[model samples]
Target: MNAAVLTALIALVSSVVGGAIVAAVNHHYSVKEDLHARRLDLSVDRLSEAYMFMLLNLTIDKDKHREYQIHLANIQLFGSPTTVSLTNNLMRRQAGEPVDVTTGALLSDILNSIRNDLGLDRIDTADLVRLNLGDEVDLLKRESSK
Candidate 1:
C-alpha cells in the first residue's frame, strides 16, 4: 500500500480499537455499579423488613417467632458488624439473658447501625417512634411506670 493510504488505514484502525476498548470498559463498570446498587437495595429491604416486624409485634407467637428468626438470619447475613452485635444482644435479652440496655434502646441502636450502613445520618434514640394501639399503648405505659 502507498505510504499515505497505509497511514490513514492505521489511524482509522487505532480509533476503532480505542473506541471499542473504551466501550468495553464503560460496560464493565456499568455492570459492576448496577450490581452494587442491587445488593444495597436488597440489604435495605431486609433491614426495613426486620425493623417493621419489630415495630408491629408486641408479643411473639409461634409464627411470629419463626418470622423473627428468619429476619435474624437475614440480618446476620446482610447487616453490618454493629447491627449484628445489637441484634445478638436483643436476642440475648429475649432469651432472658441479662443485658445492660433496655430492649427499646437496643432496638434503637440496631436502627442506627442500619442507618449508618445505608449511609444515612444517625438520629437520637429519643427521636425514634414506635406505633402502638390501645391496649398495647396502655401496656407499654404501665411497663414504663414500673
Candidate 2:
C-alpha cells in the first residue's frame, strides 16, 4: 500500500472506533437516567396513594385494608430510606406500639420525608392537622361505635 493511503486508512479507523466508544457511553448513561426517572415516578405514585389512604383513614376498614397494605408494600419498595423508616414507624404506631410521637406528629414527619424524597418543600408539622366536616366526624363516630 502507498504510505499516504495507509496513513489515511489508519486515521479513518481510529475516528470510527472513537466515535463508537462515545456513542456507547452516551447510550449507557441515557439508559441509566431513564431508569432513574421511571423509578422516581413509581415512587411518587406509590407514596401519593399510600398518603391518601392514610389521610382518608381507610386503612382501618377491612375491605380497604388489603389495598392499603399493597400501597405500603410499594412504598417500601420504592421509597427512600428515610421515607421507608418513617412509614414503618407509622405502621408500628398504628399497631398500638409505644412510639413516642403522637399519630399526627408521626404522620407529619412521614409526609415531610416523602416531600423531601420527591424534592418538594417541607411542610410544618402543625400545618399537617386533619380537618373533618361534621358529617365526616359523625360517620367516623358511627363507624367506630359499630
Winner by TM-score? 1
Off by over 4 Å in 1: 113-120, 135-146
What shift in Å separates residue 91 of candidate 2 from its native position after superposition? 2.8
Candidate No. with top lDDT: 1
Candidate 1 similarity to native, TM-score: 0.80
lDDT of 2 at 5: 100
Itemize residue pairs with steric clashes in candidate 1. Answer: none
User: Backbone clashes per model, in order?
Assistant: 0, 0
Candidate 2 displacement at residue 137 in angstroms: 10
lDDT tens digits, residues 1-146, model 2?
Answer: 99999999999999999999999999999999999998777777777777777667733778878887897787677766765776687688778998543435434555776787678898765533345665434333333334
After superposing candidate 2 on the true structure, give the runs of residues whose Cα lies further than 4 Å from its correct spot.
135-146
What's the residue-level lDDT of 66 in candidate 2?
84
- The C-alpha local distance difference test score for the whole of candidate 2 amounts to 0.69
